[model samples]
Target: MASPADDKESTPLLFSPKGGGHLDPANNGVSDGPRRRAAPPPQPLETHYFASKFDPPQIAKVSTNSSKYRSENLATPIVKKIYSSYSIIKDAIQPMTKPSLADEKRQGKIYYEDTYNDLPWRCSCGTHHKDGIWLNHSDKAGLVMSSLVWLMIVYAGFTVTLLVNNNSLPSHVGVIYCTLCALALASHAKTALTDPGSIPKRAIPNEDNASDPTVKFCNLCETYKPPKSHHCRICDRCISGMDHHCPWMNNCIGTANLKHFFLFLIYVWTASAYALVIFGMNYFLCNSEECIFPTGLVALVRLMTFMCVGALIFTSNMLMSVFWGIMTGMGTIDRMKKQEDKTFDESEEEPMAFTDIFGIGSYFTWFLPIDPIFNDYDSVMGYSNAERLQRERSTLV
Candidate 1:
């Protein structure tokens, strides 16, 4: 027999059908010849195309950007004066604050640097307070708005009823309608008077308080603001757990007074509906009772006025309440959809929940103006009942 090395050298190499290359089994099936691959097809123009970042020749292009630059750099004395005048207009309109906001700021300044208790000095910064003059701040504005709504409600239901629909209804029903209307007004007034909730002014961060949670800075307020607080354009101060500003209430709806706000909405809506029924009865009596309508231009004017009141009230409050309900229902769903659309970092605040709207399971309390057991800021700040109890116990211990 031949030696193993000679035998291996003499062994015939296998041929591969791929372009007739000699396959080397010993070389793990690699080709002995220089490998050839099919030439790649040419790429389309799109593949080769690229946008050039270089600007066109300066003489060739007169860009809109240049005009923007020119306008921004306009700093003549006349322009400065014009800008100053515009700024005054802007200051007059932008971010209307609570009445005597300057005095409020002074109070906050006194307590802004709470040393021992890092918790919000809510009395100093919170919206709920009775110290100011009667019907000032949110109260004054709300009073005006509520007064308007009440006047409409009363005029539509009670006054119009007295004029036209009153005789049609029994005494007790009329009394009930009047009472409901009055209660709605009272609820609205209470909602206005109540403080929604305010964010405490934060302690100035320094060597000692740099790491404190309550040392947040508000760019708008030019001071430290607490967590879960934001500046209200209407209130012109930071509100704690603020939901939104209601022009109808002329106030910010926030943590402390949302209960009252919800109650006001419900009562007003009910009152509006009751008024609508009264108006409907007047129309029904006009058509059904075959009653002789009041004669003379003055009486005729009163009749027309009653009809208009009913129609207007129906449009403003009844339909408006329906629209409000739709809007309110959509709010949470929209927030959830937006949350789904966004990819937030770990640090961002969460989207407001349906539960945050004040009612899901507890309809009784939600329908009325009564406060829930967990409606306070402590609860709003994500404190679970168990966690709160545990923290309390720990503090005691």
Candidate 2:
């Protein structure tokens, strides 16, 4: 029943390979399957490329914000290497400082030799000492003797005054008083004049650093002396309450002699007062006796001279006695008191030895062991006035 045209249209076409040719599905009006992607052209070989044309893929632009990059660049090993290298180089170039022995020897010898003969005493390092202050043991002894004499003179004068004022007073009383006073004066004088040279030597340790400021160890005397003791620089021995070296006495006033000095002060004061009183009484009592030196005008002049001199001596002696007594009492009290609040230089690492400051006991026996003040001769005695001036000059140079 179907026409030829309909039949032809409904029939499917099938292409067959003829003469070794492939079939074309699109030309036969049948849709072809998915087309295959075209193959890309072959890439050029990398080895044959120019070195400058490609920049090694630009190294992928890494960011330091990453912990991995930070650790790698800033390793502890590199930091430690820098530090050690600096220390080694610095140590290699550092200069060494050392002590100077030549300077020490020179200074020590100079100070020792110059000061040896002047124990307990010091020269006025200046011109003022052409006539020095004589405060030696002998002088102290003499002062004590003078004081005793003064006591006798005062008692004698007082007795005479009492006899004149009280008619009932016995004459024998005056004689007894005068005799006792004379004995006391003579005893003091004898004690004071004792030879200091024969006294035993005692070395004094450094008092400032000692356990007891009131007591010191003496190497020469081989004993500990009472407080306020100093070795006489002149005698090369220790003295108690030794104020200073006395060129006049040429000996140290040790504890053995200190009592005499005080007694002397007492006696001197008494004698001075007695002299004044006697002078005044005699002036009135013998006014009409021609006031004779040997007689008449000569005697009057002599009497006047005696009175004037006696009055002056009395006043001066009295003042000195009072002052000395007060000072000694105060000093004694001070010695009894314990010192608190000790201070020292923070900058100093070590203190000088006792012998070094006080000197060797053998040569500078004021202390127990004659010791140099310091082995460091350059710093010995500190900066003397001369040395200070020298330093000032060197600054300009």
Which candidate tops lDDT?
Answer: 1
The C-alpha lDDT values of all candidates are 0.51, 0.40
Model 1 regions more than 4 Å off: 1-143, 160-166, 202-216, 220-228, 284-377, 381-397
Question: How does candidate 2 score on lDDT?
Answer: 0.40
Candidate 1's residue-wise lDDT over 72-160, tens digit each?
A: 56657669899999999999987553334346566773212212222234333224332331122545665576567766666645553
By TM-score, how accurate is candidate 1? 0.45
Give the per-residue lDDT digits (tens) of candidate 2, residues 149-227.
4554554555444543454234664555455455445434433343222222322233232354444456665555544
Pairs that clash in candidate 1: 97-235, 128-195
RMSD of each: 26.7, 29.9
Best by TM-score: 1
